[model samples]
Target: MDVLDFDLSDREFWAKPMVERRDAFDRLRARDTPAFFAEPVVDFAPQGPGYYALVKHADILEASRNPEVFSSGSGGATNIIDMPGEFAEYFGSMINMDDPRHARLRRIVSRAFTPKMIKQFEADVNTAAAKIVDDLLDAGPGCDFVAQVAARLPLKIICDMMGIAERDYQFVYDRSNVILGGFDPEYTGGDVSQVVPRLLNAGAELQQLVQDLASYRAEHPTNDLTSSLVNANIDGERLTLQELGSFFILLVVAGNETTRNAISYGLRLLTNNPDQRALWLEDIEGRAPGAVEEIVRLGSPVNFMRRKVTRDFEMNGHLYREEEKVVMFYWAANRDRSVFEDPDRFDITRSPNPHVGFGGPGPHFCLGAHLARREITVMFRELLRRVPGIEGGKPDRLYSSFINGIKRLECTF
Candidate 1:
């Protein structure tokens, strides 16, 4: 078979059609190759030792399940090339740590998402969904669904959770888009250095905001999650100011971005497959749960996550050396033919849909996963109820290999 370029970080490669990319992954999986070399420098990082692309479902599952072997804490979870010391720690959040540290951080964060907390958030979620649908109705006929509808619910829910003022919603949203979509022309364009400065600046701005709020929360706590995070402690295990700032950034980006993209793609997927749309509309409440999973499977919002090999290990007849990077292609794994029969087909009623859209089976599986599903379900249910005829047009996608984001998508009812 001809060589397939597994350099997922390449912007041009990401810009290619989705079908072409999936076809390339299919060829790689068919080879039964344990891993393939990835370019060290793709977007803007300095040259370094390359990583391996983990394409198959089984391999990704193995890697994710064995976090000690394929460690996310060793270098950084975000990229194949290890970021600088402070930056890596800040961006990684709990995602980049192992053992006691990871366990401790997760416990503190989990406190914020306890059954009581989630139950309370449900009322807020419903209100947000209603407001979004109402605003879409006011706008009438057509609008940029990504901005007007898909983006609003998650952004509002997260901001409200943090007790942020309504006035600063756009400010937080803009910075998040910049941080996640810096490569896209709409957010940042030109040289790599230019992009880096903007990215750092965005991170700094968010840090300042979170730091200020956290300080206030410490003095006078509230019922919101920001206060919980600020005052969160478990047996003297508490997040330091820097850790709090980083976790805030993760919440803004991951909390808002993942669900936003999923909702955006849900509309697009349903638009493309009217039969499924009808299938959903026929019994909106009944189909929503499974339909949400199918949309997540197809969208695969966080395209891939990177892990570092701490020690040499063998898997699927290939040996991974110590300190080497192994990138789990979650997007590719979600479509594994072995995992999902006729994986390309958009079947809303896909039973046993074990897609790793929320990362593979691991300790680091997305914490906001339950919240995300509720947001998607509530928002789509609102859409089907209020604006059943809404149809999504072509998407203007984000120019990033990491996030499968929709920068803008027009929808008409």
Candidate 2:
């Protein structure tokens, strides 16, 4: 296919083979200026000016750093089009905001992710990973690795952190799938027109779940994040029910989906690269840090994030007009030939790996990155030790431009 043939805003573009996707991005990055694409028309929102596809690492890094100029809050960072006001109750979190509002929310949420909390979650991650592997062993092989293994760890971690009941796990999981499911027929029932309602419904359900929990936690606080959020901190700051609920939706969706997809892709990477797997197996503990970073770099699971231009600005010798939008393609940036050596190869020991899997360096850089790295490290450590010979079959990929997800991958050991 010609370089000009692929349109980033086209849904069918995401459904193409991985190689084609890579080549299209390569062509984009090879261009002197970022390619512009018309926004995908959605049922819920009016079409606006198109966005520049920032496929190169340098462009993404610069755009991420200069958040003042490239605003995430103008429309929404998660979507290319401006989000309707009703969607704010579910989708508007710190990620979609700018300072001082963004700064305030970050300060409140950062209080909950202290070292003590992360250290505690570390233990929980290990225990959960062990149980998942045990259950996988008992169930034998030929099961969906995504549902049985990859999806469970982050789901349990996030739900447990929020003090969500075990009974509500599947409820939360299904809702999250819809929120990030993109245009997938399996999740949206194959109707593009219904996508907005499905997303809003999912968001409302998740918000209600957390709000109910927040009400309970307000009266009787626990050690979980919900308790910390609902109750006042040392500074006497607290998140209102709406704030808590929206934050929970963001946490669950971002925390759960990104890590889950990373793990699934990690398995696929290992299965395809036995040498890297062997290298990791030789010293699982010692190699975990590098392996985890390599996996995240190659996975680039969260895909692209949208930012609107706040003013007329020139970046990397290209002019960006005021109010124009730009989509930072993390997956494409992660594989930029200028930055990553042998860009496509998955090398576990690739030192100085500056991939933007967790997103580029900025105020919006992933808050749960530390915990995500820990979870990936612990989960893989367990898999390598116990299910070392396990392998993932062809992935049933999620049909979405925003998230590089694997809905299901059959596994064997």
Model 1 lDDT per residue over 190-283, tens place? 6665777788788888888888999999999988877887887678877888888888889999989999999999999989999999999999
All models: lDDT?
A: 0.86, 0.92
- Per-residue CA lDDT of model 2 for 1-413, tens digit only, reads 23598788889999999999999998998898888899998877899889999999999999999999999899889999898999998889989999888988899998657666798778789999999999999888999999999999999999999999999999999999999999999988988888889999999999999999989988999988888888866466667888888899999999999999999999999999999999999999998999999999999998999999989999999999999999999999999999999989999999989999999998999999988998999999999999899999999999999999999999999
The TM-score values for the models, in the order shown, are 0.96, 0.98
RMSD after CA superposition, every candidate: 1.6, 1.3
Off by over 4 Å in 2: 1-3, 234-236
Query: What local lDDT does model 1 show for residue 330?
Result: 91
Clashing pairs in model 1, backbone N/Cα/C closer than 3 A: none
Candidate 2, residue 209: the lDDT equals 95
